[model samples]
Structures are given as C-alpha cells and as structure tokens.
Target: MNPLDPAGIFISFEGGDGVGKSTQSRLLGEWLREVTGRVVVWTREPGGTDLGRVLRQEVLHGDDMDPRTEALLYAADRAHHVATVVRPALERGDVVITDRYLDSSVAYQAGGRSLAADEVERLSLWAVEDLLPHLTILLDLDPTVGAARLTDAPDRLERAGDEFHLRTRQAFLDRSAQDPARWLVLDASGTQEDIHDAIRAAVVTRLGDALGVADGASLGEREVG
Candidate 1:
C-alpha cells in the first residue's frame, strides 16, 4: 500500500468499543513523539475535526437511521477529517494516529447493518480520496468481553445487538486477514502494557528508516531532538 506520506506516518487503531483503542492510541502517540522526535497527532474518525465532533454525536447518540444513511454520514465525517486534520498534519511530516478510520464504517455499516461490504468500503475511499492508513492495529477481543469492560451508557454501535457486534468483529478479522501487511492483529485480552509493547514493536519496524528521516538519526538514549 502506498503510504500517505513517506516521512509522515499514518496509523489507525480499530476494535469493538472498550477494546482499548483509545488507551493504546494515546500510548502510541506519546511513544512516537518521544522515540521518533516527530509531532504525533492523535485524532479519531467521526470526531477528529470540529465538524466531525457534531457528526459523531449525531451518529452515535442521536436517532437511528437506515444503514445507507448511516454509512454516508460517516463517509462525510471522514472526508472532512482527512481534508482538514489528517492531510495537513501529514503534509507537515507529522505522525497521525487515529482511534478509528474507514474500517469501523465498513464493519459497522456493512457487516453489522447488513449493507454491501464493498459498497461501504468504496464510499469511504471515495470520501477520503482513497487515503489508507500506513499501518492499522486491530485489537482483537471477544465482543461480549469488550462490552463488559464498558462502564458508561452504550453508544449506538455498542447498543447494537450481540449478533450485530459479532458480525462486526468478524468483518474486522476478515479485513485484517485480507491485508496482513497493512494490519497488525493483537489479542486485546492481554494486559494494556503487553498490547502496547506489541503495537510499538510493529510500528518500530515500519519506522525503521523513518526514524532516521524524521529525526536525522536513529533513536538512542539521547534526548528527543
């Protein structure tokens, strides 16, 4: 897959809610900034930009809509996000790690909501002008287990029935299997630090040459420049 930026990395975290995408995104952002000496932008789909925030609230907490409508709304959010937030940051040679991206839309809208999978994917690609993450980390976990971890009121996707979530989970796995090079699948059942370690190791490989490009040298005990 062609990277969005050769020097500026793009990464996305995906999983069912409470699978630790937020926690791990935070960790990865901090690590990339500290280790690679690059400005790391931590953002999320359907909520990364100001417009996305409104779309996110309406999609997740507002009234229900048909699958196609839902899918289009997410695509609109992503289009604006990539145009305003993600692309600009990457153009500046920054590492952009998003909590969720196109995959969530495909999985939830297509798999969970029973729309055509390829159509859902196509819609998103069209929205973002085919911007794909350089690397996407999928925190694999049982949907029920992930649900149990959530303490607050569930959102629209989380409130979706178990069968819907199961289908969504399978969609994520299927997508990851189809593109192993673009994805790193880790069991989310592990401890947070353990999962983070695995994610960091995978990212380090991609950043093998990027470290030199971003920092002018390999990372060392030296302070981040």
Candidate 2:
C-alpha cells in the first residue's frame, strides 16, 4: 500500500478510443467481485465524481481550450477524484478498477496535443500524490481500427485527426514498455471474453494469496461504489 492509500488494489484499463476499455474494465470488476467477493469500484477519469462530470463535459463537449488549459482541467478532475472517491475506497480496502487514469492525460495532452510529456506526467502525479495503480492493462490496437468501433457522435478527442491518435497510441505503448511488470498489454482486436480471460489470469497471478485468491477464498460481496 502506498502512503496516500494504505489498502486496496488499484487497477486501470487503458487504450485508444473504442478499444473496449469500458467493457473490459466492467467485466474484470464484476469477475473480481464474483470470485473474490470484494468491493469493486468501477470508475473513469474526467467523469468519476459530480464535479468530474462538469469537467468532462467542458473538456470534451464544451468550447475548445488551449493545451495548457486542457491539461489543467484534467488534473483538476483527477485531484478531486483521488481525494474524494478513490483514496477513500482504497483506505476501506476495496478494489478500484478505473477505465482511465493519469495515463490518459499524458496520452491526450502530451501525445495528442504535443505538450511536454514530463510536464504532463508530473502534473498528474502531483494531483494524485503519486498514487500509481497496482496494475494497468493496455489494450493494444490500431488507432484506425479502434476508431471504427465507435458509434456515438465523436467527442473532441475522438474527432482528433489520425496523426494525433497515432501519437496517443504510441504514447500508451511507450508507457507500458517502460513498466512491463505493472502493465499488461494485450491485443484489443480479440473478443471481449478473450480479453477478460487474459486479464483475469494476469490479475490472479498478480494478486494471489495477498487477496485470498490463492485458494479461491471469497473476500466479500461485490459492491460497486
């Protein structure tokens, strides 16, 4: 457990838009709750809390802002989320699975917006007090292919040009490569069930007896909060 959050397991799913991160994150959260019987907090950045919803709307749907303004807005949402929702859940020893985390800011602001990567990362670390996820799943897929999967009206990021998304995809790959032990990179082109199975296997291996899964001992009932 890190100093900011003394307990609980933190997991995150990340990828380019339409890589099925939401589907996979929810599936893994449900499976974790079913097998481990622990509280699973399924959430996402820029929309995790009430305040986050406002920020999300502004960042994605409202008027366009400069890159710095965009980065700061994301950081603001993240800081509040960690302080209110995430840190409290961790302190209660619940499992927290997020759809995206600091990595998204880095990918979007730094990679897509061409801002300084270090600056972007440092801003996020400061916001969350360096509370990195225990595990981060990067669903790797071609940006074009992933974009093809989106059905809703494209948001600001989704509407970003091809080159922007290509850079964002590369940024995610680079981050995963830098931390292979903490990251599970999988081919997102596969079926959702296949991705879930792979995530479960890795999680089982990573969590083990620490989470009482070494012998299938149920932890508690699943609670999504």
Clashes of each: 0, 1
Identify the runs in model 2 with alpha carbons over 4 angstroms from their true place.
1-6, 215-225
Per-residue alpha-carbon lDDT of candidate 1 for residues 1-225, written as tens digits (9 for 90 to 100): 454767678899999988999999998888777766778999998899889999999999999988888999999999999999999988898999999999999989988887999999989999988889889999999999999999999998889889999999999999999999889999999999888878877776765466543323222422334
Give, for candidate 1, the lowest lDDT window spanning 10 residues: 215-224
Model 2 clash number = 1
What is candidate 2's lDDT per residue for 98-195, written digit by digit as tens?
99999989998998897999999999999999999988999999999999999999998898889999999999999899989889999999988788
Which residue pairs show collisions in model 2? Answer: 37-220
C-alpha lDDT (0 to 100) for residue 161 of candidate 2:
89
Runs off by more than 4 Å, candidate 1: 1-3, 213-225
